[model samples]
Target: MKDIFTNLYNKVIGFFQAEKGDSSKVIASNRLKLVLMHDRTNLDTLTMQKMREQLIKVISRYIEIDQEALDLNLEGEGDAIALMLNIPVIRARTLEEIEAIEKAEEEELAQKAAKDAEEQEDAEGSSDESEETEKNTKDSDESGNAEESVISEEEANTEENLQNEETNETEKQKVKKK
Candidate 1:
């Protein structure tokens, strides 16, 4: 009982002696509030951290910011929750600079598309050349076969004429003998 009383007296004295701007107390209160908000919104710490990072990245695209001084928090009363963002901007990008960036991106895409189209055309051209070569080879083979058949027919006719001349000479010899 005496120890409990002594502890209570010490705590009271410490509270009175505490500094007016104690940062630790403020930090603890903020943490508690954040936890409660997260619970109420069905959100987790990892999700909140990811949101913060994405927000910073998107905001940085339009303006130069002091990332270290940025503050992001969730504040609400009852069922109405609101996101509070305090971002410090050094400077904003000019419209011309943004337009130039977009133009460069478009040009790069156009160049890539043109290169792809050229490659496709080259591939089709090679295939077409191969097909033409095959056609020429087939035509030559057909012509060669036709020429060979014509030569064989001419040889056959010449042999028939030679046989007829030999028969005539034999008949003349027999008549002379008789």
Candidate 2:
């Protein structure tokens, strides 16, 4: 009797619910795509366009450049930037110009490395003690039979010591990178 009434209630509730697509959901998906593109190239939309202009100016300084044929596009799918620089056939640049370009690339890489290091430091400081304990508890719970599955105090202390050693090594590496 209870099952029949519950089924009828569920059917009645389902009948009047309308299915609809939300505008915010679409906008959010578009925003994510745009932001990811910006993040992968490390340049926002305006900056990327400006970079194209600057690159044209630099190339024109060295040789006759066709602005219409130049294509400087940065598109990235996953963790890699696809830089497309399609300029008309021109004479090779001088040694000095090549060195200048190399320096620009190295500086960009250094900026990315610094940004990553700062983000890592921020993340390390954000995880609360309760969250860490809960993770350990969940890990232990997932490993074996409940009857014999208890972390010993000594085992916990050893793990903590190991973590400390790893932390020290990480700090040393960070200092060296500076």
Please name the candidate that would achieve the greatest lDDT relative to the true structure.
1
TM-score of model 2 (CA atoms):
0.29
RMSD score of candidate 1 (Å): 46.5
Q: Give each model's whole-structure lDDT.
A: 0.75, 0.67
The top-ranked prediction according to TM-score is 1
lDDT of 2 by residue, 108-135 (tens): 8999999989867876777787567768
What count of clashes does model 1 give?
0
Q: Lowest lDDT 10-mer window, candidate 1?
A: 151-160
In candidate 1, the residue pairs with backbone N, CA or C atoms under 3 Å apart (3 or more residues apart, or in different chains) clash, namely none
How does candidate 2 score on lDDT? 0.67
Residue-level lDDT of model 1, residues 73-167, one tens digit each, is: 78877788888898868998788866766677789899999998986777687867766776899999978866765664465457546655778
Residue pairs with colliding backbones in model 2 are none
What lDDT, from 0 to 1, does candidate 1 have? 0.75
For all predictions, the C-alpha RMSD in Å is 46.5, 25.4
Q: What lDDT does candidate 1 reach at residue 73?
A: 78
